[model samples]
Target: MRDQDVEPFFATLQAANPSPETELEYTSVFELLAAVLLSAQATDAGVNKATRRLFPVAGTPQAILDLGLERLEESIRTIGLYRTKARNLLATCRILVDQHGGEVPRTRDALEALPGVGRKTANVVLNVAFGEATMAVDTHIFRVSNRTGLAPGKDPLEVEHKLLERVPAKYLHDAHHWLILHGRYVCVARLPQCWRCAVRAYCDYEPKTPPPGDRAG
Candidate 1:
């Protein structure tokens, strides 16, 4: 999408849902960090469901460390890669308590240095917790950006860069949430709901999905 189309695009999305937030639930930076780590390859609802019980008693590094790996495994066992996630969580917590004063580090290097915290995880923390304008290109954002011609790119990193450059400053903070939600509900992977899409007219996707038996030449 061009610079001129940026305003109306976000305006329409924002009007629909005035306040979009990450589905992941957490009380503090530590809980948010831990939640994002466990959320890899998992749904926000699932992560929230598991963390809801876990955070009350053991949200911080020291608290989670006290709970031990076995208990942590039990808490998040329902999520995919639970075993691996459990190990990473324990190790990361230990490092945080020992090295970072049990706080979520602000810099990407420090955040990524923690076990299980990759670019995407760090990006989410940076944006949601620190109010950074960074975009974390997940499967949902990836599809929506490319499909809608908002910021097409070959890979997640490229897409993120393009979005940062293309997205207007006013809407930069919530762009990730908007795009992800749009993909999850409207511009879906298998069959985009073109008819109901808010920015359907602005999209550059040619030969857009048509209604059944409504093919065009």
Candidate 2:
């Protein structure tokens, strides 16, 4: 996509939803971090379902650490890879309590050092929790960026960097949320809903898919 089209493309998305936010439910940075950690290979709805029960019981690092591993596993067992995620969360909580005084670190290096946190998780925490202008290129964003020719790249990191470089600075803070929501709801992997896309005019995807009823029988 040309530099000129980038701003309007994002402007269209911004206009449709003035304030985009992560679907994952959380009241604190630690909770958000843990939710994102558990969200790997899981849906936001699923994570929220589990956390809805889990958070009220133990929302903080210290509280979660006090919850113990066995109970924590049981709490989040509804999520995929719950055992692994539980273990990572426990270790992460320990680190938060020991190293950071039960606080979620703001720095990328410190955040990534947590057991379950990765680059994407760190980026999400940085952007949403701290209001940093960072992109967390999940599968949804990855697909949207490439399919729309917004920032085509072979991998998430490449797409992330390209998006940061290409997206208008004014929209950088919420760009990830907009792109991820668009990909999840509109530019889906199986069949993009190009017929009703807000930015369809700017998209470079060829032979855009028509609505289901419009398809040939």
Write one digit per residue (lDDT tens) for candidate 2, span 153-215. 999999999999998899999999999999999999999999999999999998999988999
List the candidates' TM-scores in order.
Answer: 0.94, 0.98
Stretches > 4 Å off in candidate 1: 211-217
Worst 10 residues of 2 by lDDT: 1-10
On a 0 to 1 TM-score scale, where does candidate 1 land against the true structure? 0.94
The whole-model lDDT of each prediction reads: 0.91, 0.95
Q: Where is model 2 more than 4 Å wrong at Cα? A: none
Itemize residue pairs with steric clashes in candidate 1: none
Q: Give the per-residue lDDT of model 1 (tens digit) for 1-217.
A: 7777877998888888888899899999999999999999999999999998899989899999999999999999988999999999999999999998998899999999999999999999999999998898999999988887898999999999999988888888998999989998888899898877888888877777887568556
